[model samples]
Target: MFLTQTVPRQREIIEVLFRNGWGYMRKLLTGGKPEDPQLPTPAVLKKIFIDLGPVYIKLGQLLSTRPDILSSAYIEELSTLQDEVPPVDWSEVEVLIRKQLKRPLEETCKYLNPVPVA
Candidate 1:
């Protein structure tokens, strides 16, 4: 387990930016467009993540580990935030795994059971 520090000041800054940016964009998109039916929920979440910037997203993710800080409702909603971030390509994953494990991917997992029930 790892212990991490919280920079509440940074979090507050990011929250302010995210809230303001989100409000501005939301209003622009939704204003006078009552028939637009709104953007998809996942789209809204991803947009919020983008507007909030990286620090808030990281903080939210970290906060999910601490139930004592945020209420369960907020945590649940924060957990739903998709960071609008693309994953490393599969080729990159292979390269990183090989580099970290100092072995070919096949060699590292060759003898491992396909399914290990915990």
Candidate 2:
């Protein structure tokens, strides 16, 4: 019932939940039962957040700050959640840099590395 046209990402979210073995969330999403809520293991939860992308990573980071809600183990694990973005191609980044500078990339910096450090 909840998996309607309006919520297009519902299916994807459910799939991720299922893949991560988050039984409680899967049940909640698919409207299986109204049982007590339960969370997966801390590491599993972190993996789920990672699979869900930036928004959920941010949510996990925020959740990590809440010592009252999560146990130390969960907080510790979630605290390490970093946004794992794929590296952008140097060509794309060079173009953006050129646009921002309103000039050639060479004119701005003498020795800019193509590879990202961070």
Best by TM-score: 2
Best by lDDT: 2
Candidate 1, which segments miss by more than 4 Å at Cα? Answer: 1-49, 82-118
Per-residue lDDT of 1-118 in model 2, one digit per residue for the tens?
6557747687677788899888887677677985888889999999888887768888998999999999999999998874444456789788878888999877778889998775
Superposed model 2: Cα runs more than 4 Å off? 1-6, 29-31, 82-117
User: How many residue pairs clash in model 1?
Assistant: 0
Query: How much does each candidate deviate from the true structure in C-alpha RMSD?
Result: 11.6, 6.2
| Candidate 1 local lDDT, 19-42, one digit each (tens) | 645454455545543443333343
Instruction: Please give each candidate's TM-score.
Output: 0.31, 0.62
lDDT of 1: 0.54
Model 1 lDDT at residue 71:
63
| Pairs that collide, model 2 | none
